[model samples]
Target: MILKDIRNIYHSELDALFGKEEVDSFFNVLIEHYLNLKRIHLVLDPQYMITKEEEQPLFEALTHLKSQKPIQYILGETEFYGLPFKVNEHTLIPRPETEELVDWIINCHTERSQIVSKEPQTKILDIGTGTGCIAISLAKHLLNTKVSALDVSEEALVIAQQNAELNVVNVEFIHDDILNSRQTELVSVFHKYDVIVSNPPYVRNLEKAEIQPNVLDNEPHLALFVDDENPLQFYKAICEFAQINLKANGMLYFEINEYLGAEMIALLEGYGFKNIELKKDLYGKDRMVKGVK
Candidate 1:
C-alpha cells in the first residue's frame, strides 16, 4: 500500500480528535520512527511502499492515539531538556513547563559560580523523580557535580535508571518515598544537598476537569494529583525534608501549580527559606518557585 494512503487514513481517523496539524505531526513522527522515513521522504516519493509487517506498529500506535493516549507514551519515549527519555504508565511525561524549570536551574547554577569547588563538588537532588529527567538533565549540564534522584515507585525508578544510563549521565537513583517518615530519615542521612528540586504531585483533584483525556486516562495519577483540600501535601513534605537535608546557603526549586504561587511563597517563607522567587513559564503562568536555605 502507498504510504500516502496511510497518511490520508491518519487524517481521516484522527483529524477531528487531535486536529489536522497534530495528526500530520503524529503521522510524520510515526513514519519516521517505524519506517525511518522522514516527512521529506514522503514528499520526495509519494508512492512509498512498505511490507505489511512495517505497517503493524504504525496502526497499533494509531489505535492507541484514537483512544487519546499520549504520543510520548505511545512511542515509549520523549525528549526533555533536549535529552531523550523513556516513559511509560509508571512515569509522567515531562512537560514544556518543566523544561522551563530545568532551564531556570541550569542558568542559575551556571551563573552563580564559575570557580569549580576546591573542596566538595556541588550536589543536587531531585525528589519524586519519575524518569530522572530533572536530575539527569542537571548532571548533563552542570560540570563536576553529583546528581541524585529519588522516587517511591520501583517501576518508575527502573525507567529512570535506564534513562540515566541512556543519557550517559551518572545519577544516583534512590528508591524511597519522600512522604514516608522512615524513608525520608534514611534518605536524609545519605547526603545533604547543595540544591534540592522537585516537580511533585501538585495538581489537585478539582483540576482533573481541566486535564485532557490523554493525560487523565493514560498518565500516572500517582505522579500528578493531590487532594483539593490539602493540595500542598507533597510540597509541604518536600519542604520539611529540605529543611533537614538542605545545606546552609543551599538552593531549592519546585515546578508548581499555576494557581498556588502565593501559597507556595508563604510555604517557603514559613519553612525559613529565604530569597524566594516565583517565576512564570513561557505562557506567563506562575509555574516555578525557588528559594535559598
Candidate 2:
C-alpha cells in the first residue's frame, strides 16, 4: 500500500481506539519510526509508498500503538540530550525535562572550568540510571568528568550499559539494589564524587490510576514508583548516600515529583546541604531541586 493509504488507515484505526488527536500524533511518530519520514516528508513526497515487507513491521507497530504502547518503546530507541539511546520495557523512556537537567549540569561544569578553580576531574554518579541517559550524557558533554551509574535491576543495567557503548561514552555501570542496606558494594566501589544526580522512581502507588496506560502497563514499575505513603523514599535514600559519599560542597541534583518541591527542598536542607535551590520546568511546575553537600 502507498504511504498515504497506510497513514490514513492507521490514523482511522488508532483514532477509533484512542482519539483523533492522539492518533494523529501516533501516525507522525510511526512514520518517523518506520520510514525515517517526518510530517514534512509526507507533505513533500505525498506519493511515497511502503514495500510489502516494510508493511509488516508498520502494521505490527500500529497494533501495539492501538494498545497504547509508547512510540519510543515501539521504535526501540530514542534521543536523549541529543544523543541516541536504546530503550525497552526494562528502562523508562528519557524525557525532555531530564535533558534540561543534563544541560544545567553541563553549563555548570563549563562555568566552573572558566574560573580555573574547578576540580581537576569532577566525578559524577547517576543513581538509578535506568538507561544511563543522565550519566552517559554527562560523560559525553563534560570531557574530563568520570562517571559511574548504578541500578538495582540487572535488566535495566544491561540496557544502560548498551546505551553507554552506543553513545561512545565511558561509564562505570554497576548492578545493585539501592534499597538494600547490605549492598555496600556500590557505597565502597566509588566513594567521593563531585556531583550525584538522579531521576529515580518518584511516582507513588496511589497515583497509579492517574498514570497513562502507555506507561503503567509497558514501563518498568520498579523504575517508576514507591509506596504512596513514602513517595520521597528514593530521594531520601539518595540524599543520605550523598551525605556519606559526596565531597564537601559537592552538588546533589534530582528530578523531583512536582507536587513535593517544598518538601524536597526541606529534606535536602535537613541533610545539612547548603545552597538549596528549586527550579521549575518549561511548564512552570517545580521539577528540579538541587543542593550542595
Candidate 3:
C-alpha cells in the first residue's frame, strides 16, 4: 500500500481508539520513526507505499497504540537532549520536563565556571538513573563533568549502560537500591559530587487510577511509584544522602510530583538545605526543586 493509503488507514483505525487529533499526529510520528521521513514528505506523498513486510510491524504498532501503549515504547527508543537513547518497560520514557531539569544543571555548571576563574570539573551523580537518560545527557553536554549513575534494577541498568555507550559518553553505572541507605554505595573514584540529581519515583499508588493504562500496566512499577503510606519516602532518603554526600555549597535537584512541591520544599528545608527553588514545567505545573547543601 502507498504510504498515503497506510497513513489514512492508520489514522482512521487509531482515531477510533485515540481521538482524531492524536491519531493524526501519532501516525505521522510513528511513520517517521520507522521510515526516517520528514513530516512534509508524509503529507506530500500520501500515496508513498510500504511493502506487506513493513505493514506487519506497522500494524502491530497500531494495535499497541490502540491499547494506549506509549509510542516511545513501541519504537524501542527515544530522543532526549538531542541524543538517541534506548528505552522499554524497564525505564520511564524521558520527558521534556526532565530536560528542563538537565538544562538547569548545565546552566549551573556554566555559571560556576565563570565565577571560579578555573573551568571547574564537576563530580555529578544521578540517582535512579533509569535508561541513563539524565546522566548520559549531562555527560554529553557538560564537558569536564565526572558523571556516575545509580539504579536498583539490574535490568534497567543494562539498558542504561547501553545508552551510555550508544551516546559515546563516559558514565559509571552502579546498581544499588537508593531506598536501602545502608547499601547505596558511591563509586570510590568519584565520591563526593558538586551536584546530585534524581527524578525518582514520586507517584503515589493512589494516583495510579489517573495514569494511562500503558504506563501503569507496562512500565516498571519499581521505577514509577512510592509507598502510598509515605509519598515522599524517596525524597526524604535522597535528601539524607545528599546531606552527607554533597560537597559544601553543593546542590541537589529533583523532578518532583506537582502536587507535592510545597511538601518537597519543606522537606529539603528541614534537611538544612538553603536557596531552595521551586520551578514549573512548560505546562506551568510544579515539576522541579533545587536546593543548596
Q: Could you tell me every candidate's TM-score relative to the true structure? A: 0.98, 0.93, 0.93
lDDT measured at residue 225 in model 2 versus the true structure, 0 to 100: 89
Task: State the lDDT of candidate 1 residue by residue for 1-293, as single tens digits.
Answer: 88899889899999999899999999989988888888999889999898899988988998999999999998899999899999999999999999999999989888776544454688999999999999999999987789989999999999999999999989998899887978788976868899999999999998899999999998889999999999999999999998889999999999999999999999999999999999999999999999999
The whole-model lDDT of each prediction reads 0.92, 0.87, 0.88
Compute the lDDT for candidate 1.
0.92
Q: Residue 131 deviation, candidate 3, in Å?
A: 1.2
Backbone collisions counted per model? 0, 0, 5
Give candidate 2's error at residue 126 in angstroms: 0.3
lDDT value for model 2: 0.87
**Evaluation by TM-score, superior candidate among 1 and 2:** 1
- Tens-digit lDDT string for candidate 2 (102-202): 99889987898888764588889899999999999999999678899898889889999999889888999887766775783456554698999999999
Clashes of 3: 5
| Candidate 3 overall lDDT versus native | 0.88
Please name the candidate that would achieve the greatest TM-score relative to the true structure: 1
The Cα error of candidate 1 at residue 150, in Å, is 0.5
